[model samples]
Target: MTFTPVTPSDIAPGTTRFVQHEGAAFLVVRDGDGRVHALDGLCSHALLPLAGARVRRGHVICPHHGARFDITTGAAKGPPAHCGVSHYPAQEKDGMIELDLNP
Candidate 1:
């Protein structure tokens, strides 16, 4: 679990932010309730960026093909994305959001 610290101020509540670390792209999302999640930046369906997608009820809808993925478990919740995305462990501590980059 190699965690990388990210600035908490960079992520606004109820929005998804794109970040890159060690040549890997990750999507860091802060839900409406303040819970933060990190997942593979690309959608499983079309390999499109998930940062521009919409987050609704803990699921992220792929902007390209309407594929929905659960932010917490990275489960494919709808059509087009039968394969689930990768979910990384995330935590907030000391005003910083730390993500497990190796996960």
Candidate 2:
């Protein structure tokens, strides 16, 4: 699988960051446990900027409408959110986080 290095693993938790590559945007946030989870930068239910959303309880909440999403499976977790976001495979090696995004 092809992968693009996004960010380093040394980043502190609770800090949300953005990564744009190949026309797709990625929202990378270091969870409370220090593991990084990257999801689509746009909310699946709406065109909201996910960078402003809260990363709580391992779900990316839509900053616009409170729609919740599961980062692990890219699935919508409730109503007002019926669409699922495209999730790329991610891996952390050494001290960097990488994502495999398809066009």
Candidate 3:
């Protein structure tokens, strides 16, 4: 996948934002340390939208069944979600947040 540009200001520190690229939904988050991460917007357990999912302790808690996934590695960190979601490489460039959708 190619790098898609997004508004950096839309995602604040310690918050999450939903973005669409090439007709696919993606979740972009800014950690407490101000680092950006990108992940597939759907939960692996039931394919539920993870847009409003809570971010705590470096994990995104699924709103549907309480599944938690690591923001950095996309690893499943709790029950009800044995499988992990997909993670994309993200970085800041030219005052924008760029995500590698193909990663």
Candidate 4:
């Protein structure tokens, strides 16, 4: 699978960043534990942007509302979001965050 590269420094630990790769929006997250994740940038609940969302206890809380999504599995963890967003394969390589969008 092809991979998209993102600067690791762009996403600090315990933060979420908005990114556009290959014409699609994505949320790059660095959890409190330093694990990286890539998920659809829009909240499934209302198709709202998750760019500045909050990360708590391995979950990304939607900024628009109170919906929560699992950073690892992209599963909808709370109400108003019954459907999960796409979870892309993410890894660190060569000092950058690489995302497999086609995975």
* Top candidate by lDDT: 4
TM-score of each: 0.87, 0.80, 0.90, 0.91
Candidate 1 vs. true structure, TM-score: 0.87
When 2 and 4 are scored with TM-score, the better candidate is 4
Task: For residues 1-103, write the lDDT of model 1, one tens digit per residue.
Answer: 6778865646777788877777777788888888899888888888878868778988888878899989899999999999998998999878788888676
Candidate 3 wrongly placed segments (more than 4 Å)? none
lDDT of 2 by residue, 2-103 (tens): 779887766577666777777778887777887777788888776677867677787777778988888777788866789877777777887888987753
Preferred candidate (TM-score higher): 1 or 3 = 3
How well does model 3 score by local distance difference test? Answer: 0.87
Of 2 and 3, which scores higher on lDDT? 3
Error of 1 at 28 (Å): 0.7
Worst 10-residue lDDT window for candidate 1 reads 6-15
Residues 1-103 of candidate 3: C-alpha lDDT, one tens digit per residue: 5788965645778888887777788888899899999888898999888978888999999888999999999999998999998998999888889998766
Off by over 4 Å in 2: none
How do the candidates rank by TM-score, highest first? 4, 3, 1, 2
lDDT of 1: 0.84
